[model samples]
Target chain A: MAVMQIKFIDKIGEGTINKIESLGRIALFFAVGIIHIFIKPFQGKKILDQIVFIGSKSIFVIALTGFFTGMVLGLQGYYSLVRFGSEAALGSAVALTLIRELGPVLTAIMVAARAGSAMAAEIGVMRISEQIDALRTMHINPVRFLFTPRIVASIFSFPFLTALFNVVGIFGGYISGSVILGINQNVYMGTVIESVSIEDITGGFYKALAFSVVVTTICCYRGFYMHLKGEFGARGVSTATTNAVVQSCIFILIVDYAITFFLV
Target chain B: MNTPLIQLENISKRFGNLDVLKGINLSIYQGEILVIIGKSGTGKSVLLKHIIGLVQPDSGRIYIQGELLEELPSAKIKSYQKLLSYMFQENALFDYMTIYDNIALPLIENPDVIPSRIREKVFILMERLGLRGIENKFPAQLSGGMRKRVALARALITDPKLVLFDEPTTGLDPVRKRKVHEMITEYKEHFGFTAVIVSHDIPNIFNIAQRIAMLKDGGILFEGTKEDVFKSHGKILNDFEMGKEI
Candidate 1:
């Protein structure tokens, strides 16, 4: 029994040390990855390619998500405000909710699920196939060739996706409030226009930008270092991609709350 | 005496509890084909990776072109990488790229090579490799032999002085294997580049290898010419010669 207890304590100590070491490596990957942005010999073509992938290809999904979210917000806010005999505030509530929170948060989640996961899987496959090692052997830096553009593209895409979501969601909210609920159209539009200030809008952009960096960096880091775990072949890539998506989602939520807290 | 183009002194590496390479000491002459052969899981690839500075040694040193690899700064190391090319065992072709683009990558990355020169070099290589009509097709569309040839083309496009090949003929058919071996020999003769090959091709590689290094039990059991290995007697060497892994 005493020996068992000693073994358990040793396992805990080892686990803690492993966690610290992993965190340090992650921090190092991020520092170098971000610092590469300012350095010369940037690949303009690669960046453009990634932007087309992460930004343009993502528009349809973001629009659909935003429209549905706005409609739901308008429906929910109307019912809630009616209880207090203040149904006039329904438009403001729907617009504020869509613009200040759901726009950035929902867009981030979508990007994480769609683009971030794809990035992770693509890179994870590259790692498993030794294509990454091939790049290094060819005297090319994989981080610069593969990753910097991805991170930069994510940074470029998220804010634009967030803005699109806000526009579509606001329209959805307006349709639900005016056409469906019989709230005055002019009054709903007016309330939404008046309720949303520049600060609230800018706060959401800040959240979107921060959340993009966190998700992309974490996902890429997971995929890039997936080989270090000593696992090989398809299982390693699958596990790496799974970890990337799950970790990206978790970080997006955490970053969202942290940014929202600061803005509030 | 041939000057040592690359040297390893007391190199040792351990992956977890397994000592993959132990006290590895060897030298490759400036213009010779050295084949390092071993059983599967004997760290032959790991040793090849060490020469290119892809895998850092846990202890010991490696010298390339008279410069200690580890002593060079990261930028210098990258520049030094231009002097060498490593053709992967798995081919490692970019699945997203066409065969033409794949071969063109090394040349395109060099700013000194203009677009016309890049196209000229890439097409010439493709033609030499019997890959003319398939330039626009992606890697997934190619056969295993074609993929390997494409990778070889990519490696040689830069005109590197030293080339490392990890099992260049592993999954190839007999005809394709012979073709690959012939290509390596022809390229070496034409380019006069030194080669460090890791293979299990046995008699097939005997014709090409200037020296053979037999690895067993995580150490060099034999290192010399093919005739020297054929005349010697050892369990590991005989087993490998007779197509058995000990």
Candidate 2:
């Protein structure tokens, strides 16, 4: 009985130590990846390529998801506000929700599901196939060659993508509230324009920036260190990709909550 | 005797509880082709990786041109790396890159290599390796033998003084394997670069090996020329010779 109790405590201790070690490694990896962005011989072409991949290619999906989410928000807000004799404030509620919360969070989740998974899988394949080792053997810093451009692109893409989602979502809200519901179009637009402040926009941008780093760092870290997890071949890569997307989405929500708490 | 270009002294490595290499001591001379042979998983590849800094020893020291590898500053190590190139066992070509871009990568990365000469150098090597007209194709688009030649082309493109090859001809046919051996011999003479190869090709490998090192049970069991290996016929060596164990 005593030995069993000791073994349980030891297992918990080991798990805690491993988690701390993983966090330390991730923090260091993030710092090195960001620092390489400012290093000389900048990879301008690669960064631009990645921006196209992560931002430009994501426009259609972001637009579609944003439109549907905003329609739902508008429909729900109008019915709820009507019961309170505050139907005119429906536009403000929808705008605020989309701008402050759903815009950055949903956009980040979509990008995480799409580009983040691809980044992890691509890098994980390279890791298992020894291409990363090949880069090292050639004296090329694999982090600079692989991670730096992705970091720069994510930092550039996330805010732009969030802004796109907000615009498309506002239009969708207009379609639902004014066109579908019997709300006055001018009243809806007027409330939307009046309620949104510069502080709200900037705060959303800050959240977007934070979420970008979380997504890129976690995804890239998972893929880059896939081999160290004692898995090999296709299984390692699949696990890395799945973990990257799952972790990125989880961290996005966690970071969103923390940022919102401080901002509020 | 001349000073060895690279020397390993009492090197040891352990992966978890398994000791992949134990007390490994070896010397590699300049401009010589040294082949290391052993059974699979005997750390032949690990020993080669140690030379190229892909893996570091758990204990002991490695010296390159009389300078201890671990003691050198990072910049000095990079400079040392400029003098070396490694060809991986799986021909680790960038699948996304074209054949031309793959071969020209090292040259493009080196600040000293003029940008204008990269095209000419790549084309010349491609032609020499019989890889012309396929420069725009990606690595996955090429056959296995063609990919191996492309890997060889990339390794030699930098004009390195020391080249390390890890199982360069692992899955080739007999004709392609002989062709690869011939290419290694011909290139060694043409460029005069020291070569260290990890292979299991046995008698076929002996043709180009100026010196051979046989690794077994986590250490070098024999280190000498082919003639010396044949003369020193212990039971273990006989097992290796008769293709019974190795």
Candidate 3:
């Protein structure tokens, strides 16, 4: 009983600390956002580079994930609907799921795992090497100079990425149902277009916005506070990167559930 | 000469059970080379960190130009940070950025500096440091001594009132170490900024240090002019001179 009580108390303490850290991260994100407004985005060649990085380069992964997600939904919904003799409802199920939940959550997690971790690692390395401190001594706020562009880019790009995912996913479902399962092309297309409401689309977009903030904030926080109380080396940086991804993934899921619950 | 530019009074810092700096008091004058010598793990770096407000003292007061640093707001503290520069032990040049970018970082970050003028200043510093042609080269591509020089150039780029060097010559060959020592002297001469160097290289520092402070067991064991330091027969000083622990 005593050990259990101790564990409970420890958990409460941990939760409180996490809450404070979350608030701090929110403040940092807003701070970066404010700074980004003052600084102009990359000009000419640099703008082209960022466009290639955040948009064109992400196409293959985004499309692949979207397609697989749609096919999986089609396959699963088909079996469940057949039990109820409502197999035609597969299109509705696939469309709703793709727009309301899978679109934002999956894309966010994928980006967090790939790009977010890399950003954390890059910034973490900079922190440990005193490059961040060098920036401060030079009178440059690291938040404004280093983090603003990333946060701004993520906010700008993530919703579009989710939209791309949703469109591709619905098409994948169509290909699987119509081309492979012998459903009529007109029926599949009509069901997807008609069943996917504006509410569903708007809900997904909102979740994408939240997911972008969560992932970017967590990744930036992990990098910013990489060495808080003690000295952390390469191993620490790697661990922080891993933790950032895992935490962001978990946060994405929880936020997805909350948004879905409220939207429904 | 006219009230030391920086002062630490009753400064103490403890990391858990270990006390790193114990009630240390010192004052640093402008345009003077103050070398702090001690054995490894003697809190030399910690002392230097306190001066720059990087690590706050546990129970003491730090003043820059008679202004209490710890009591100041963060924005006020930030302004003070601009006047001081620290060259880390590892020559902490950002590895991902090119040499020119690393040197230009301070200028780029300062809101007061225009981007066009920043570029000009960076180029000028690069030229002066004999690093003009290697602007695109990363720190990984530079030699250890060259990296140190680049870091020094970055520190001096801001034209700071004070510059802190933490083990500036630790991992270099003798020739390279001498080169760094000479560079420190040259920078002091050129910029006329106060310097606080933490090092174990006694002979090299003796050439430039106007005053010397020896740290041991989280306290200042001795502090005086170079002539006084050499003339003293204190046991710890003598032991340190003879490469033995007291």
Best by DockQ: 2
* Regions of candidate 1 where Cα sits further than 4 Å from its true position: B71-77, B111-116, B234-238, B244-246
lDDT of 3 by residue, B176-215 (tens): 9999999899978888889999988867778889999988
Model 2, residue A133: distance off in Å is 0.3
Worst lDDT 10-window in candidate 3 chain B:
B233-242
> Which stretches of model 3 miss by more than 4 angstroms?
A1-56, A83-85, A229-231, B70-79, B233-238
Q: Comparing to the true complex, what docking class would candidate 2 get?
A: medium
> Rank by lDDT, descending?
2, 1, 3
Tell me the DockQ of each model, to 2 decimals: 0.74, 0.78, 0.56
What TM value does chain B of candidate 3 have? 0.95
Give per-residue CA lDDT, model 1, range A1-264, as digits (tens): 999999999999999998999999988877777777777666678888988988899999999999999999889888998899877887789878987889998998888888888888899899988988988888777777777888888889999999999999989888887899998888888898899999988999899889888888878888888887777778988788888888888888888888888888
C-alpha RMSD by candidate, in order: 1.9, 1.6, 3.2
Docking class of 1: medium
Per-residue accuracy of model 2 over B158-228 as CA lDDT, tens digit each:
88999999998899999989999999888888888999999988679888888888899899988987678
Question: Candidate 1 or 3, higher lDDT?
Answer: 1
Candidate 3: tens digits of C-alpha lDDT, residues A98-203: 8988999999998898778987888888888887776765666677665666666777778999999998998888877777787677877888888988888889
Give each model a TM-score: 0.95, 0.97, 0.90
